[model samples]
Target chain A: MSHEPRDNPAQHREQREPEELHTPIGWPLLVVFLGIIAWGAFYYFHDLLSATGATSEAGDRRSVVVVDPTAKADGAAVYAGNCAACHQATGMGLPGAFPPLAGSEWVLASKDIPIQILLHGMSGPITVKGSLYAGVMPAFAQLEDAEIAAVLTHVRKSWGNAAAEITADDIASGRKAFADKSTPWSEAELKDKVGAP
Target chain B: MSLSIAFLLAMTFLISVGGLALLVWALANDQFGMGQQAAETIFAPGEVGEVEDPATPSAARAVMQNARKAAHQASDSEELFERTIADQSSRMPVLFWLSSSMVWLLLGSVFGVIASIKLHLPDWLVQEAVLTFGRIRPAHLNVVAYGWASMAGVGVGLWLIPRLFKTALVGGHYAIAGGLIWNAGLIFGTAAILAGLSDGLEWLEFPWQTDIALVIGGALAAVPLILTLIKKRVGHLYVSAWYLIAALVWFPMLFVTANIPNLFVGVDQAMLNWWFAHNVLGLWMTPLGLAAAYYFIPKIIGKPIRSYGLSLIGFWALALFYSQVGLHHLIGGPVPTWAVTISIVHSVMMVIPVIAVAVNHHMTMLGSFRLMLYSPTLRFVVLGAMMYTFASVQGSMEALRSVNTITHFTHYTVAHAHMGLYGFLSFVLFGSVYFILPRLLDWEWPHAWAISLHFWLVFVGWGIYFWPLTLGGWLQGLAMLDPARSFMESVS
Candidate 1:
């Protein structure tokens, strides 16, 4: 096979190093070139504006808003999002800082006392499960009545604590009762109002 | 901020003026005067369209040359040249570098297979800390990238530059020394990695001390190539020479800058790491692969490239676009939005050079498709050329924000990377090695069937390796994107 090129001189001319012809680039290539450039330039500016937060909700353009008109507020999810960081997912609060919500008389004792505490918040050293916890619990007054009620109800039933479910009506009444109290409440003040739980 | 703006303006002015000055100088010197005649410079007297192989008798070639000389006197200075002098000079260093690279290639593949197995069976190699998946994976990456791929690229360049320049390699001894030094560095680096003494960077796992060794070795290797280019007998520089020179220039700068200790931190480090990593492919491996493709494809088929002008555009555009496209890997990361956006844009713009290259190779090989059956070099090289187009286009797609949002941080990205590096770069390297070794060793392949066997094994193995993984990775990306799925479910 290798000898055939040599056997016939006209069959195979001597091979040379690769060369390039002077052919012109066609129109399809030109179209692709122009199209990519235009698209790239447009995408850069458009996505850059949104990515830099130049518009509302532009940080994540894929964040779709799902407005569920008939949806119920999930208390477990609310707990995970808001309270689980300090209280823990197991409802077991930190040893000395955060008070435990599970199997605690403060949460299961009286529904109104817990509601008042949630609405006004508490700062002074409070007793939970016979231990003193001095950390402050922030006011959840911003949460809807149903959200607050649902969260309290969730805490009551979890972690071996059996208690009646709190209703939105109960939370609404608690809000009305504490409407004038603008500041966080002391433990003593709460105990006095609730008749020493 | 205002000072930076003024500096940038000054730079812009300087570049424009410099470019204009170069154009004027080029025109005055009649740089483009060679015209169509310049393309013929690669061929020696009576060299075009002739079948010259290592196995072919020199007496026959001399006879053919005399016949051609008698028929037409194209140039008065044209004379019969002996390629034996250059081939003999290149024999030692090229063989040494290529053989060492093959050793590393085997070792790297072993490490890669181990890592892949560990992904499926965690307990398979857990007895030794050195063999742990974390250590094994980086070792695989670094060994293949720095040892196998880089060494092979340099080896090819060392042999090719001399061939293209039509000169004996001036400092072949230095290249041999460089190969030894390079292997020593790889040994230390891979050992250090297994022993948990890594730098903790992705592509830069080797410690700074080892990096210095690599830099020195690379410089030593580059000396012969530069000397050969300087001592070139040919007046016209081929397209392959251009790409090889650019690769040699770009790689050291990237390696040195990226390895500087404590220069970058946090997001800047990430950007630098990716920039260096991606350029290792784009500037280093891609150029080497393309150079081989440009040379071997036409050399095998006995034809010139389709478009000279398109080749120029391809080379310059690749330099312009590939340098900036690295930052696209950090899209949606904490880096500045504008920085990533610019990278994405450059990545998309890569289509210009890619298309230019694609057209040049495709159209050159258009009528010569049948030659692939007779030439094993053509088969692998053509596949490599095709994959270069496919991988680069897919890379452009992957850089888009819409595509990246799903594919980023997924196995899909891994598959794409393999497509570029192994599919495109490694295949080209394989083809080049096959073509080069025979010439260097002065031996024809003992069996044609063995070559076919090797080609099919690699080709079929690659298909089995790539397709299922690509499909699985895409599905994995989709599963991961959905918030409704649990982690276990997504992975499973």
Candidate 2:
């Protein structure tokens, strides 16, 4: 074999394999990079830690039922002010931009489901009326528990979707569930999960 | 759409596809494993006296002294020995890619000028379907930003990165594939917009399908670059490589997240839209231009960078400050006062990175100012580096709430955008192109006049676009701002 090493003795050849090489700062930077990445991952998923709300124990209307008419009324007005922008005033939507709030299972289910959905946000492929709606719902977790409660109550009643009326207590309960967590919900992971308060 | 518009769109797609396919063919054939040890070989005597009937070495020296033209033809140049992908890649391919980019840029510029004037002369180009300012304006942007600038950046990056690292490209095929996919996205997106099917979000205006295509292309281009860097034999990572890689990561993330229906929902849309729009400038295009500045300034002067530490400062500060500062775009919007406050804070705090880069570039060229006259690379790089400072200051000034109220929806915004995109980024790209094209192609520019014409066309034309006209338009908007008068009456 013609052993004509073009320039200097290469460390690559001396090491015999590419895997033997290392970044100059070695594992520390790689570790720091990993740490940064891990922190980012934790931040992305932090919502799961603080996730809480209604506790459903089958056939219990208390969990899924609306007790206060005033709570429902307040929720409706709040929903009109906030949620109305995307879902639209008529509960329809701007077609592809925002999904309809009317008759949405995510919006109408147990108060726990909508509460969590509102707080931390939900993402991915969802089915409403047999049509798969892929949308990103931003977290309204920043809003007061009462505001979230009122908005959910409003969406449930005002829209053609009439389910359980959401009370502030229901939402407040949900807030205690994931007090320390706040990552946006990934659609695939939470697709089959229960609804929030 | 008119036949010409249709034809232009189709031609753009065809050119992008062909260019991509050519790169893929070259990569698969190991064309990228060219004479990457250029730096090592650059110092050699070359093939001057090494021909079959060798000319005397002294005779070769004398030949070199008299006229470079004769010496260039007579000397069996190092080009005679070069035959890698770098060699086979050829000048025509590079020029073909570059000229296509420039063509798109010119088209975009013409459309933009019309759009600017059409604020007052809505009847001028509003008569036609495709020629409407709404359609033509975006078509212009697609051509210049995506078609011209991005394509040219990739072309130069592909050629330069591998050469600098003295490495054979392992994933160049993926880059080619990505380039085609990206171009397809641009064409489809531009066409959809021109068809009045735009999503109507400023900068996030493209439809979903186009968005997906662009992200995929970004991944393809990024994969090869990441691979090349990993396999590189270089001892130290250059500042230029850092900027190029950072852009690759930034562009894809912005494109994917911005267009995803699930991520940017409702109220978040306004916030996310500005985030993506600014990054496309700060993260995507700025990095490409900055990389050129880092490379050309030092390379032209034949010295190490003035301070590698400043380069590091510039890179990280940009990452930290630019991302946080996007909220400034929501200045007058109802998106919360805190967000606006943070954006303005970071926008002004942007001085750190800009100054770092200025120090590095200016100090490096401290004694080399004389070379600006002799070297085209130095002139363009200095021009771009200085413009970077100017644009960043203006960007900060514009982000202030009081200033934004006067300029936000006016032509001043357009002028600020032109200053950053064209004034800063385009000039840097031009310098990089001048420096790399000759090295990549083994042949001198066949027609220097054409290249000079291209530069003058861009620089001189921008004066007309931005200087007095854009400023006057903004002042006129401010005059129309008094609360006592009707909107129409004030404007009139």
Candidate 3:
């Protein structure tokens, strides 16, 4: 059958007789396929070996350092992990629940106040910047003295509150003093023991 | 902070000014002067051993001269036809790339189906960690994006660029090598991801070890087209060629820039990730798809595009605007407000190019509507073009803060994404395959019924896939906004 000639010159030129070229599955493709297979095998085995190696290394390392838990705590890191959720990253804590540590009289007063709070926990209505916040601050008693000191130091120094650094020795003393207190302390009890802000 | 801001502003200013200067230099140098002659070169009569015209002094003499000229023209046509046939036949590399893409498409579909099913029945494939939903979802995305879309796009470019340049493809071996290496990379990358070795970045999940293969593969694949462009017979760069070349250039840069590990940290890393992710759609897939649509729509209909000026506007505007628009993905996130605002502004500016392309395509298809019923190529191409306009405009709207407030973290974004990737890009690729395969293989498709059935099934399926998700997402957003609505209620 004869086809009609196209009006456009480019279209007319494009209407060419069909010709097929025989392109067999060549050697390059085969070589590449083999190469891929080899690479995949290597990658899979390497990943498995490395994963096992890491776990074994971790296991070997853990046994030696099981009892020594005096690792230096990064103040910023401790605050981000433990304190940021309720007090907030800016230290402008949630209204009517968690009190803001930023420029709070209690935070700036003394290192012993925060050290006691970290080791023993705190509860009841606490007035900060004229707003009363009543919430339970869980005792991070499981944390090492160094971590407790670091977090207390972080909160005091942060959010425009200028205060003295809290040391691990101070945290140790605070924990020793609060050893018999099983329950969280009220605002009045904390103030009475640590001195009024 | 102020100093850094000033430095950034200066850098932006310098880049813009430098780009403008280069454009001006090109314009003044007459680089684009031979438009009409270049456009006609592809169709000009082939050489017939330099046949000389005899001076016609009488009627008989004129008739004899005319007859001789006709004989020469006919032989020239025959020679041109043979050359074209040889050109079409020499595309084995493209076929290789396309065939590999098909395999990936099937693989991706399997992953997608499994992932979708797991959403409802999580325990179905819970035995193996590799077959988990988290692994399967990324694998599906990677297979579709890199394996199917990218490979198929390269295949089309390899064929289309040479045709536009009116030259035989130069580096067939390079393209084949690239395709093979690319497939190897995909195999390794997907395996790694399934084995829980993912880098944990969306769209950039391929482990660094395997990603290097993709970079090398992409560079190799791009060589042939770059060679074709350098050796082009015509002076005028067609709009399709502009898009094709830009895409080839943009992709490697985007890929390399995004994959540089430890170069950015924290919020900066998120910014770069979104930048790379969005541009993969905008700069890479969108350009290739649009280029195919632009070339096929006019070529099939036997007409030039409606407006050359509009095509240029669309191409340049897209290049300029689309780059900055990716930051809109991080709206309301930790990134600077100025960056997000700039992205939103650029996203809206995208409408300029979208409309330009829309008008050009719309006017071209205005008188050729009847062809869609008869031509499968036209049917898919036209529909894809329309969807491109729709999806891009919807994307611009979604980038707006008002609309984004509702659409963020909702299934509406997912629906929008499918509309762009599947409805626009994939549909265009399907049309391109249908149009190109016959020419490349020198054989007509075996079944018209099958083609029609495939089209309907996908078309209806896509409609079903997109609409409910879009509506449900909007409802979900509204429910989320209302304090009275519970999370469970909204989810249900």
lDDT tens readout by residue for model 1, B410-483:
77888888888788888888888877776666465566667778888988988887887778877887888887
Please give, for residues A77-160, the per-residue lDDT of candidate 3 as tens digits.
889999899989999998887888899888888777877777778887888899888788998989988888888888888878
Best by TM-score: 1
TM-score-best of 1 and 2: 1
Scored against the true structure, residue A47 in model 2 reaches a CA lDDT of: 20
Q: Count the backbone clashes (under 3 Å) in each candidate.
A: 6, 29, 0
Q: For candidate 3, give the docking quality class from DockQ.
A: incorrect
Sorted by TM-score, highest first, which candidate order results?
Answer: 1, 3, 2
- What's the residue-level lDDT of A72 in candidate 1? 68
**What is candidate 3's lDDT per residue for B1-492, written digit by digit as tens?**
243553464354335334533543443453545354544554555433211111111232234334334434332554355345334534688899899999999999899999988967879998999999999999999999999999898888887876777667777789899988999999999999999999899999999878899999999998888887787766666788889999989999999999888889899999999999999999999999998988877755544577555575578768876888898899778776556765676677677678778877887777667656666667788999999999999999998888998898888998999899899988988888876775566455666667778788889989998999999999988887776678777777
* lDDT (Cα, tens digit) per residue for candidate 2, span A1-197: 12222321111111000000110222332354334334433432232222223232333233354577544346666766777788788988767667787877667766667777787787777666556778888888777777887677677777467787677788787778877666777655455554432
The alpha-carbon lDDT assigned to residue B418 of candidate 1 equals 84
Clashing residue pairs in candidate 1 are A13-B49, A13-B50, A14-B48, A14-B49, A14-B50, A15-B50
TM-score attained by model 2: 0.59
**lDDT tens per residue, model 2, B381-450:** 7888888988888898787767887777676777778888888888888876765554444444555456
Q: Which stretches of candidate 2 lie over 4 Å from their true place?
A: A1-197, B1-100, B485-492
Candidate 1 TM-score restricted to chain A: 0.66
Question: lDDT (CA) for every model shown?
Answer: 0.78, 0.64, 0.75
